[model samples]
Every structure is written in C-alpha cells, then in structure tokens.
Target: MIRLEALAKRFPPERQALQGIDLEIENNAWVLISGGSGCGKTTLLHLIMGLDQPSQGKVFLHHQHLGRLSAQARARLRANIGLIFQEPHLLQRRTLWENVAFPLELAGQFGRALRQRALESLEQLGLGARATALPAQLSSTERQLACVARALITGPSLILADEPLERLDPQNAALVTDLLRARHRAGGLTIVQTCSESPATLPDATARYTLCAGRLVPSGLLER
Candidate 1:
C-alpha cells in the first residue's frame, strides 16, 4: 500500500505542482492518477518512486517513511517498485533482451540464471520473437512492450506507469492494457497508471482519482 500525507511540492517561481495530497493506495489495487498535462500527476509518481523528495510532506510505502531513507537505501527500495516511464526509455545501443536484463544484473543476479529470467520476461511480454532486436529497430509499441517487460521481469511489488499507452494504436494499446490487467488480477500487485483519457484496463481497481488544480479529486468507485 502507498500513502501520501499532506504532500506538497513547490517550485518558487514555477508555481506549486502539488498541494496537500492526502490519499491511500491499497495493496492489490489499480488506480489511475488521472489528469491533464502539468497537473502534477508525474510529480506524484516521482514522489512515490522516491525519485524526488517532497518539499514539506511524507511518502510512505507499506508504512515505511520514504523520506527517511538514504540514497543507497532509496535505490534498494526502488528495486521493489517497477516503473514504466511515459516514453519507452530504452537504450538505443542495447538489444531488446539486453535492456530488459539490465535491471536484473544491476540487482546482482547473473549468469545463465539471468539469461533464463530475461528470456522468460520477454516471452511473457510477447517480445520473445524480437529478443535479439536492437532498440532502434523496434517500433514504438514494441519498445513500449519491452520497457514494460523490463519492469516486470524484476518482479517488483508495485507498478507505476506514466501515460502507458501514449503512442500506440488501439490494437497494441489494448494488448498491453490487457496484459497489465491480467497481472493485476494475479494479486498483491499495486498498479498506478496515468492516462489522458481512461481506457477500460482493469475491472477490479481499488478506486479512481482525478488530479486538477494541484489537488486530487475523487472521480468514482472502481470495482469489478
């Protein structure tokens, strides 16, 4: 579960990005940080992922204060949280499988075990056929899938995706969304995704909240 308490971030002349965000995300939940551009949706993700520290509030992951962690501790904590950025964010020089395996290696798993795990991840993401393909050669949707596979291959507890289907055509987008829902259904998986317009991704979400004017507004009930 994730909790945000009095979360406020201000950039002096740039205006306030978030103001007094108080919310709770339960385990086994899929919630969209619904919002328009510049509404601090992405900023909220950063706070959750511990990529950026809050200006005057606290972010708690499973009841542990994220702000209390050191830099190295923060990295360790992020290993337990998978993130899919708005962009594919893959390395051009690396092959598709290599990019997916990067996180595993960074986590200290290696050798044939690493290769097997990476291959399995690609297989699950339906990118097994393109495992050897380089990032520059893959299509936007393909790269996006690879990025998602990279995140899941590590088996993180939570998934935080920013504009997950930003560039895909309907078909590819649906495919990815379906896969995400399947994972959510499997349990104890907390997924926080942001999309400009809502897509019927998961049926058993915990709740849905909208971000506007730097505040979180309740949208509706989310359940099966």
Candidate 2:
C-alpha cells in the first residue's frame, strides 16, 4: 500500500508541478491518473518512486516514510517496485533477454534462473521469440514490450507505469493493458499514468482521477 499526504512539488523558480496531492492505493488495487503533458502526472510517479524528493509533505510506502530512509534503504525498497518509464530505457547493447534479466542479475540471481525468469516475462508480453534480438532489431512496440517485461520480471509488489500504452498499435496497447489488469487481479498493486484513459486500460481500474495544472480534479467514473 502507498499513501501521500499533502504532497507538493515545485521546479526551480515559479513553476509548480504538483500541489497538495493526497492519495492512497491499497495493495492489489489498480489506480489510474490522467493528465495532459506538463500536468504533473509523471512528477507524481517520480515522487512516489523516490526518484524525486517532495518539495513539501510526505510519501509513505507501506507506512514507511520515503524521505526518512537512507539512500541504501531506498534502493532496497525500490526493488519491490516495478516501473515502466516514459521512455523504454532499454540498453541498446543488451539483447532483450539480457536487458530483462539485468535487474535480477543485479539482485544476485543469474545464469539459468535469471534467463528463465526473463523468458517467462517476455513470453507473458508475447515477446518470447524476440529474446535474442537487440533493441535496434525491434519495432517501437516491441521495445516497449521489452521494457514491460523488464519491469515485471522481478515480480515486484507494486507497478508504476508512466504512459505505458503510448507509441503502440491499438492491439499491442490493449495487450499491455490487459496484462496490467491481469497482474492487478492476481494481487499486484498497480498505478498507471496516461495523458488520457483509453477503453483498453480503464475498465478494471479500482479508482481514477484526472490532474490539471498541478492539482487533482474531482474523482469521476471512467466508462468501462
């Protein structure tokens, strides 16, 4: 579970990215936050991931204050979180399987086990055959699916996806969305951000909210 209390973020001089955003996501619940570009949706996710510090207020991960933890502690805690970045962020030099297995290798699992887990994740994303291919050999959609495989390989307790369905064909977009929904249904907490909700992704959301000019708009039901 995660909780944010009066969270706010301001960049440099007068620009504000978020203002007093308070939210709670229960374990296994799926929440979607929608906002146009520059509207602070990604800023909110970064704060939650502890990649950026909150300018004010606090962020609690399962009741532990993020700002209160040391760097090493935060790094350890992050292993429990899966994140799909706005950019795929895949290493061009590594093959898809290697890229997906990198995190597990860093966490001390390698060789057969690492390959197996990475392959399983890839297969889940319908990318099994591309495991031996480099990033350059894949299409934009394949690249994104590789990123999703990388994120989910570790079986993280929570998933934070930033505009994950962008840059994909409708079929692929729906595939990825359904994967996330299935993960949530199977008891993994998920939080996704998009410029707007799509029919492919919003149907199973436990809660939904829109953000505008750094503030949360009133909650509304998203058509399934």
Number of the top candidate by TM-score? 1
Model 1, 46-70: lDDT tens per residue? 8888989899789999788999989
Pairs of residues at least 3 apart in sequence or in different chains that clash in candidate 1 = none
RMSD of 2: 2.1
Quote the positional error of residue 198 for candidate 2 in Å.
5.3
Top lDDT model: 1
Backbone clash total, candidate 2: 0
Instruction: Give the per-residue lDDT digits (tens) of candidate 2, residues 49-89.
Output: 88889999899987899999988888788877788888888
Separately for all candidates shown, the number of backbone clashes (residues 3 or more apart, or on different chains) is 0, 0
**Residue 132, candidate 1: how far off, in angstroms?**
1.9
